[model samples]
Target chain A: MAMLDVTPQANGTAPQAARKPRSHARMAWTAFMAILRRDIVVTARDFIPFLLQVLVQPLFFLFIFGKVLPNLANSGTSSGFGNTFTVLLLPGIVALTSFTTALQGVTLPLVLDLGFAREIDDRLQSPLPVSLVAVEKVVFAAMRGIIGGTVIFPLAYLILGNSFQVRTDAIPQLIGTLVLVAMAGATVGLTIGTLVKPEQISLLFALILTPLLFTGCTYYNWSGLSSIKWFQIVTLFNPLTYGSEGLRKFMMPPITVTTPAGPQSFTIPTLDAQWIFLGLGVAIVAFFLIGLQTFRRRVVS
Target chain B: MAQLTDNAIEVIDLVKHYPKAPVNAVDGVSFTARRGEIFGLLGPNGAGKTTTIGVLTTSVVPTSGKALIMGHDVTADPIGTKQLIAIVPQQSNLDRSLRARDILTFHAAYHGVPRRERNARADALLAEMGLADRAKEKLTRYSGGMGQRLMIARALMHSPAVLFLDEPTNNLDPQSRLFLWERIQQMNREGLTILLTTHDMLEADQLCQRIAIMDHGKVLALDTPDELKKIIPGGTSLELRVALPQPALVSATGTAREESGLLTALRALPGADKVDEIAADPNDPAQEGITRYRLYGQDAGTLTAPALQAVSANGGELRDLHLARPSLEDVFIYLTGRNLR
Candidate 1:
């Protein structure tokens, strides 16, 4: 065979004296940013579909529970229960949209990336630790969740006018809750995304997602679940319940209901603001670690 | 470490056995490629070529033993190994949503190329791969060959020290394959060490400076193409096609059977070493009544005259005759007892 007579120098050249090897932290950060940028660009190019996916469920919930049900109830007794239900349901919609969107954003892409497409192979070749690729996916998905939640917020007021109320005094806490809830959404997405096979995706939605949404305090506040003691305990295992309750506590005003004995007032269960924030923080770390470990195992092997 | 400075890749006793697999996919394989040479792993499917590349490229950790790329142990310092090498995988794994140019640019950025240099390098690579026209088009819009060229461009975005091309020309049309071959040769000329895996014997013969022929998870033979060809029984072969249905037995006194008569005459030639009947094409109906014979010898010219004389004496008409030098395919068959393809 013909041989090339290019530079016959071996090892190409000596490592440049002026160029120091990058610290591990720097390399990891660069890889993270590059992957994040690529994913964002891809997502932006498909923005219309992404926006539709994020908005569809929240809009559907707002139109049905926030607008239709309340109108249907008002036509009967002018009970004001319709208005109160709308206020309570608004926060749940935001939380549910954020969590489910985040989960789908991570899981579906991951399934495709790891299975037929193998697009993640490109990112796996990066100089960063293999686990960091999983973390990057989680981080980006969380950002999408936050974006989805932000977009859904205004539509609630537009569709359920004069029904939804924002507790201005709790605005600071609300913003914090939103951020924590978004992170939790992403963390759960990462964990489930890494655990699932492409073939099991349909089962994921059927078995896992459907249950999480219904029992996740999306329809009723956790405080109201006290009547069904077993359900209250079981729903506590769902991370979305914390986010939903947290959003309700910060986003809505107290609702008064008349009992047979007398008129009484109750608010959506707080589950305590401290515990909600703490649970979200812990879940974020725990799920992230698990996802990272699983991702590294899958990619390396 | 010292060997690593001179060699772009080194594998020592590398083995990889998937969980529950009955046998190792890459079993105890070892080879080394110099910094400027194009080394090939030529083998049939399931011959462990891709698995070996996977181990050297740090994608699959070995079950035992070690592999190093540019002096960094792959298992101990995979990031360092990855930094020194890039792989053009057998399949098109490029992001379908991204445009051709963005794929290169993003890959460069991931490898730590400066932003300004990333765009410039990506453009240069796109132009080099003949993909400048499609730079702005999404990969989903690219034809198979175009997607392949784009993948080659992406793999070179970072200008890695060593490039691993796994079946790079598998599904290309003739023109695309030739284009890629010329491009690969040009890259090697510019001093990039390449490790290629292909089941194409002709491809290995034309492009590789040295090749390791593997089969059934083991290296059957490793040498330059000419040297490998020399490993077969004889350096040349004379093939004769004759009319069939002649007598099977041969007598020494000219009343011999046609088949034995021809064999005796050819074996009595000056340079004839071995003689055998060539199998007819099973799918060709015309092949049923025709007899083909191959005479392996040191020189085809020396055996030609006697081979022709034998056919004439036996009253068998010689329809066609061809002489060929031993090729890599022949050598592969000799070593593995099966055709390479």
Candidate 2:
């Protein structure tokens, strides 16, 4: 028979004689989920900022380009043929909305907190690997990206009216496009967050984000750059172009065309849809790797 | 890798030097903490105590040395080593955005505490640390004491083999400091190894089983409280208060002197044990003329009746009598000619 040793208890409750060992596997799951849950909950703390970031900008773009720009173009034309403007602007609006939402949701806060406020130190100390913490941030950004993109959809649909085809068959492709686009955007945001110091963050806004907005294939398609060969060559360096072009292929496949009349047509031509999607995927993975490595280095060293 | 021992902590010449600083922050500091012991690392500000704790907790890597917790090298296997240790930073790093209870639960989950067990542990720690009432409140609403308590509870989430506290009560009020000490003592009683750093001599005296005083990035002294006090040659030099602080015709009994007041220093008299009661100043020192003797004794009670009579005969008023014993401060002065605090 095994003998049991007795230890005195501070409380009145007698020792239970048997204590259970902890399950580390279960704890890992709890840790990951807890981070995700906490991040989600705290995002609600700044409700107005969240709304402005996720809904306001997308709405502004949709109303301006989706509704106003096309209307303005139609009024100038006696025939009132501005319906194609809606088709062209809707996909770009979706891509732009997701990009902005993802960038703000993950990048700015991550860089500031990890660099100056040091709010992320608590999470880093958790039993979870540091990479999981970074992943949680990206995951939260992805969720917000989906929300921002979806918010613009109904408004764009109302503006596009019957001319905007739902293309139910393209739903799967659209969802796939959104996921890839969000990943690419968020990963790029993470890369930016890692590269910029706390003081240099505003410089990133002026220099990096501005360029991203212009060249991210939001207002125009890759094929549209044919008129300016140099501009097309420069845009090849912008990862956002691949994401926006891939999204256009998914949301408005019929719009993927080129008149070849203007030196730079305002439509996507010569750019292969499959290649754009692959490039976006590749850029997303590469940025994630670099960002994660940078994050790990910052946390450890 | 080394075999695990009953000692939860073993540090061998742990050294850490920052690139920006000219000297090493922690230099060749080595110590061991047995299981269930409250070991203390004491030093003045910038004395390398926090840096040493950082190395042990795997937060900052050591420059050239190694620290092992439960047989895991802190540098080579930080994840495995961190699994057995938790650190309470000098500054509060609790997520201000998180509710107090969620803070506890989140820390638990991060340490791989099981989901079902996490809530129970969180509740128990909160209640034990007197934080249960405020557990639902956000951290931004917590006071200094409450934040420190929450940090302590956070460290307990994993039930780590060794808990490292870096100045756990630095800015806390006295009452909160006492409360935290009691909880830490309770934790130690349950067979958990605790390593703490502080410059408060009184705290170290009360809680540490063994202490190491560090200064200028080096260990000045390391010993049990009683043994450390022995470093002072003639125990404590008492300063007795009489109506007249200035003694007339100061005389030396044994190896002691009447420095000030009715205070007389006796080198090695009898009946000067630690439990001996110390008398107060005379009621009317100016009128009745109070006389006090400053008794200086070695090994606690080196002054006694003979020395007292001699002081009384030597124009000293016997208004109040008092005996002082060597404190950790005296040991600090003996080692570095300065107080530990």
Candidate 3:
């Protein structure tokens, strides 16, 4: 018979002197930072593709609607329409850029990680609560959203030369609105990323994203929608509408037009800055809690 | 200072049931591995070996029961338990986007290895696993064997007290398998306790200090390989090939000549305890005019003469004879009434 000879060795090797266990707070912090840094490095290495994903659609929108259409229709400084349209379109592009970049950042990789690739298993095994992994993903997505906004802001100006302007007085509001919008983008990304199945991802573009873009107050302001009563009520539920309106109020120049009734000024109606900030803060907390719960359940089970 | 425990792993009646599955993946399984020993859980696929490892590693939660790693309950203190052990899962779960060196470095960082030592340890581990040359390559470009080696290197980043390998050699070539085996043995000698799961009996025999044979979600047997092999009916076997004519008649000496008569005579021989006729294919050309018999007992040499004579007297021509030692495969067949793989 083929014999298996395995003699048990003495357990006599002196165990290394036991060291004090690190405090839970310190360990958790270390693990969290490590995960965050890894994600940032991976994103940085593949930056070109990431940059392209963030810039492509916004660039096309700025070129076509903000520049080409206005010039082609012969509506420029002479008609006062070209500059008005550019002011309206620039903020919309920034909001859309932040929204889509954050959404794709979290959802695309999440679907792949949770589905066939299972690359997330390594992160799941870290010595931290599983919920923290989901939070780290949100943090990274939010950072990407902010980066997307910064990249697109300069590109918007390049595309709509001399049409778009940033008022020095509104700079603080612009910065605050951008930060809140990025946070909202990340929280929404986290929720949708965890809730949707890989197979159902295409449906997200059709059912969720299409509606968000059309009703998102990108081409029109919330006050302009008041002329259409039902739409004014309906668009309130779309989170992107608030983001677009907030950017419009903070980043664009005031619209002035030449009319039969002398020089008339039109200001797009927007929610109070306090209300926008409050709404975004509430959304961030709500989606984060929901995403964390769903992520924890999926990972543990 | 806390004292070290002798047992590296202790699983107690662990059970894991998928929410909608008909049966438990792991059903009331229990075992222990002493510190500094390489223990194996041997089973065919779907025999709960991976599930057992999953629960012990805290990747999969158990429905009930408890598992302790290095004296910390996995459920009660999962992070503490996770800090104490590392696993090389069966699948290639490494981040494909990261370079080979980055994979190891990231693992070390996650496990709280000091930042100053992380790069040096990653280089040393890659070198030890024979992967230093390819350390800068992306994981997407790695071969299956290379990926498996990287996984092993990554798992050792923390210098874990216990290491779990779930079918580490599943798809490895012979040379790679042997290399991995040697590396595993070296790690064990250096005082790392290992718990590995594999269906290959020979692998378990070669690497395990003790094994728990599992089947159908439960452990069927647990012992050293030598002792498990001894559980078979007899330690040795005698195989005999006899040529017989169609519509066979009695032997030339006029004694009984059927398969039953031959089996009885073989059993009556000294040192022969159990005798059986092995079934053969009726359509096989090589076996068309032959009969095969197997006798299980202590010594085949002593029974060789009488066995051949018995066949000849029964009007059958003695074609071939051989004595063989029973293997772990035979023992598994005897225990489960099925093949191990």
Best by lDDT: 1
User: Across residues A1-301, which tens digit of lDDT does each residue of candidate 3 receive?
Assistant: 0111221221112222232468766777788899999999998999999898888888899999988888976643468777777888788888878877877788788877786688888877878877888888988888898899889878977887877676567888887787777777787888787888889989988997788788878877778777799998888777777888888878766677787788888675677777677767787788889888877777776
| Model with the higher DockQ, candidate 1 or 2 | 1
lDDT of each: 0.81, 0.71, 0.80
Q: A1-301 in candidate 1: lDDT tens per residue?
A: 1222222221122321123568667876887899999999999989999998788878888999888988999899867688788888888999988888887778888877776788898889988888888888888888888888888868887887777687888888888888778888888887787788999989998988899899888899888888899999998888888999899889888777665777777665568888787778888889888877877777776
List per-model TM-scores for chain B.
Answer: 0.84, 0.76, 0.81
Residue-by-residue lDDT tens digits, candidate 1, B48-132: 9988988887778899988878778889988777777889999999987788889989997888877886787677667666777
Error of 3 at A281 (Å): 3.1
- Would you give me the overall lDDT of model 1? 0.81
Displacement of the residue B278 alpha carbon in candidate 1, Å? 8.6
Docking class of 1: acceptable
Lowest-lDDT window of 10 residues in candidate 1 chain A?
A1-10
When summed lDDT is taken over every stretch of 10 residues in candidate 2 chain B, the lowest stretch is B272-281
How far off is residue A295 in model 3, in Å?
1.8
